[model samples]
Target: MITNFLHDNYKNITRVSILDAKKVFYPMKYVLEKRDILIDDDSALIILPFPEDIKYPSNTKMTDAGMLWDYKVEISINNQSALTENQLMRFLNKKVIVVFHHNDGKIIFGCNEMPLQYGYSEDNSVNPAAHCGYSVECRGNSYYSKVST
Candidate 1:
């Protein structure tokens, strides 16, 4: 099977700073050869969404590979942070991903020949507690007929 096995080639891995509201991060690493995601290896991007954290997938569009689904994840430190205003503002424009919680089984976006693209946001804001955060939306397009995990 073909895979993107180039070591340390992901550019998105360089945008981590503080924690979100739930102490998790986004846009974890995707190892092609392993067919698995590296959530907590060298980064703090383990976004295990809670049952209520799973939001709706919006902005449907057709892709050459398959259907592209956009997922919005609200990440805010709010009252759970210690970063300065400028430091907290760095979370914007960073890549993110779509997350979900499944007890029956685990779900993986995209497929063998194709992987999801990192998502970004248009707007970000700070809370009353002087924390910065925004809604990051990522897209996943499957190559096959279904979104196989």
Candidate 2:
């Protein structure tokens, strides 16, 4: 249900843009991957591989109060894009606002806590159409609702 909730909520996001310290625009592509969802009872909990021995307590009450769900979004840079990998890293590593836009609405995912870092991909020197990618972890307390156009 969590994965479906994320996909249904964000699947419409068609664009990702960042505003740097100098207010420069750097648009990037988001390479789709099966989104990783981790449910935690605490807001400060870091997600880890689910433990096999862990069992859900039957008497547990459901509340969104301190619940936190982390979604790992993988963004990419297309070779044909106007921006380069170097250019992206320069501003992305610093404080910035990452905006996700869809046809109906948008979400301003605050990057103040989630700092983007460089990641590796297979060499595409031989291939003419390969994309470079980076990982970004976005945290949210409540599920997003789809807005009406």
Best by TM-score: 2
lDDT of 2 at 114: 34
Candidate 1's C-alpha runs over 4 A off are: 1-35, 47-50, 75-78, 83-92, 98-101, 108-149
**Top candidate, metric lDDT:** 1
What are the per-residue Cα lDDT tens digits for candidate 1 across 1-149?
A: 11232333222222322222123322212322224333342333444333333343445567664445553334332232334333434434433322232332223444323334444333344555443443334344433222333
Q: Which whole-number lDDT from 0 to 100 does residue 44 have in model 1? A: 32
Estimate, for each residue in 49-101, the C-alpha lDDT of model 2 and write its tens digit: 11221111112223443223233334533343334444444543444444454
Report lDDT (Cα) of residue 66, candidate 1.
43
- Candidate 2: segments with Cα more than 4 A from true spot: 1-9, 20-65, 80-83, 111-149
How many Å off is the CA of 97 in candidate 1?
4.0
Task: Give me the displacement of residue 141 in model 1, in angstroms.
Answer: 6.6
CA displacement after TM-score superposition, residue 149 of candidate 2 (Å): 21
Candidate 2's error at 38, in angstroms?
Answer: 29
